[model samples]
Target: MRWEDIKRYQVIEALLLWEGKLNARQLMDYFETSRPTAQKYISEYKQLNPTGFEFVSQQRAHIANDDFTPQFIDLEFSSYHALFNTQGEHAVTSLVETLPQVHRNISPQLVRPILQAIRYQLRLDIGYISLSSPEFEDRIIQPHSLVFDGTRYHVRAFCEKNQDYRDFVLSRFSGEFAFEGEATFDEAHDTLWQTDVTLVVCPDHRLTELQKKVIAHDYQMTEQKLELKTRAALLKYLLQHLRLDIYQAAAEQQQIVIDPECRKLLAPYIN
Candidate 1:
């Protein structure tokens, strides 16, 4: 099928699944097309499965049938939200603006084995490189879960070489990983993954009253302070991602500080 026709079919399924009905006016307004064009699209879709919808003259719309089955799209909110972000067919402009990002280069080759290992409790023997070591080394690891720290994906796994749980960046795997065997370590044994740590943050004490207020407003803080909770194993990554790893920069540059007690508690794990 043509790309345009697939998009039209997906929108039709989205409306039917979410709103329980669809009308030509919804299509006309959404696609900015003529009445006959909207009707033609609906007619074309109905021809694929005549039992998918039933017309209601009172409502002037086609209500989805009790046995309606979508062929073009699944009922996932993320998929619907992605379609919604386009703001309808042929929309090119957006009301929102976001910072530019250079997408990471994580390949499906690395992701697939990690997912399979996590699912079946298997071990992986792979070559990995680390910034600290600067060379590829072969090791066995049992992946338990996957994590995305707002920037990139990390596999939370038990490293047989290190004898502990560690977060391995997906992009850092240097070569193909093969399933070694069943995993001997289990997720329940990873204490850090099971624990929660609270990070209390406050506007830098050195900032002026107005500056502190602005910082508080930016973070939606209550009384110039905010407390964030994260998994103990992820506390370091969370701090690094938020640029709160070190509270030693100039007050205006840093903007925030971790509570001294919280910093002390996290000291052993932050490195």
Candidate 2:
């Protein structure tokens, strides 16, 4: 199937799972397709997964089966939010009216060269602004991969200026960038990016028993602890996101604490 068809089918599947029932008209409006095309997709999807949905003649809609299981769409919080936050008839009012978002202007001009450099194994000369430096400076970097840490986009690259592998935030990149011949380093050589680190998180020991229970349940912790593995380079960001970096903070403030062993492993990365 075409990529577009697959995406539309995934949307249909998500709608059925999230809203319980969906009709051809809704699909037509969402995909901006003809009624017949929308109906055809629904029919094709139903035929592909016979037991997933049932046709309701009275409602003229396809309702999810009792034992319906999602295949194309991941039933994750982010996926659900993306599916419902679209600008269309199927858009849903978010439960949280005001959500925090990182404000950064990322230009396609800056991103395109970085992506091309990574794809074609090339180097790039870029102007970047960092927290330590107020002015943008020229830097030669061997681009590797792009990472999204929820709030912003980061390009993991080998910085010639720093003589090390580092993350350059996309938004902080200034001016135009150009390909500067073949790259000296790839993703394989990025030690931090290549290495995996496990983070064991538990409710702050300072919290009361009841508070600990609530924190455990909130994090869906098993046995009062949650273990998550991520790239070593991303450990600091993940810790900061979960408020685990400030171990000395009060239980009500930090809520969770990292295991001492895990903390020791993450020491180099943690600020």
Clash numbers, per candidate: 0, 0
Show where candidate 1 strays beyond 4 Å: 1-92
Per-model TM-score, in order, reads 0.68, 0.85
Candidate 2 C-alpha lDDT tens digits along 1-271: 7988778777788778877887887777777779999889988888778899998899888899988887788877666557656643443324324465667888777788888998999989989998899799889999889988767888899999889998888899885777789998998999888889889999888999999999999999999999999999998789777766566656698888897777887778676
Error of 1 at 219 (Å): 1.3
Full-model lDDT, candidate 2: 0.83
**Candidate 1: 10-residue stretch with minimal lDDT:** 88-97
Q: What is the lDDT of residue 235 in candidate 2?
A: 88
lDDT of 1 by residue, 1-271 (tens): 9999999999888878777899888788778889999999999999987899989999999999888889999977555556666673433213234456767667788688888999999999988888897888887999999998988889999999989998898888865777888999978999999988899899888999999999999998998889999988998888887788766658988998887888899887777
Q: Which ten contiguous residues of candidate 2 have the minimum total lDDT? A: 87-96
- Superposing every Cα of model 2 onto the true structure, what RMSD results? 2.8
Deviation from native of the Cα of residue 192 in model 1, angstroms: 1.1
lDDT measured at residue 101 in model 1 versus the true structure, 0 to 100: 70
Clashing residue pairs in candidate 1 (N, C-alpha, C atoms within 3 angstroms): none
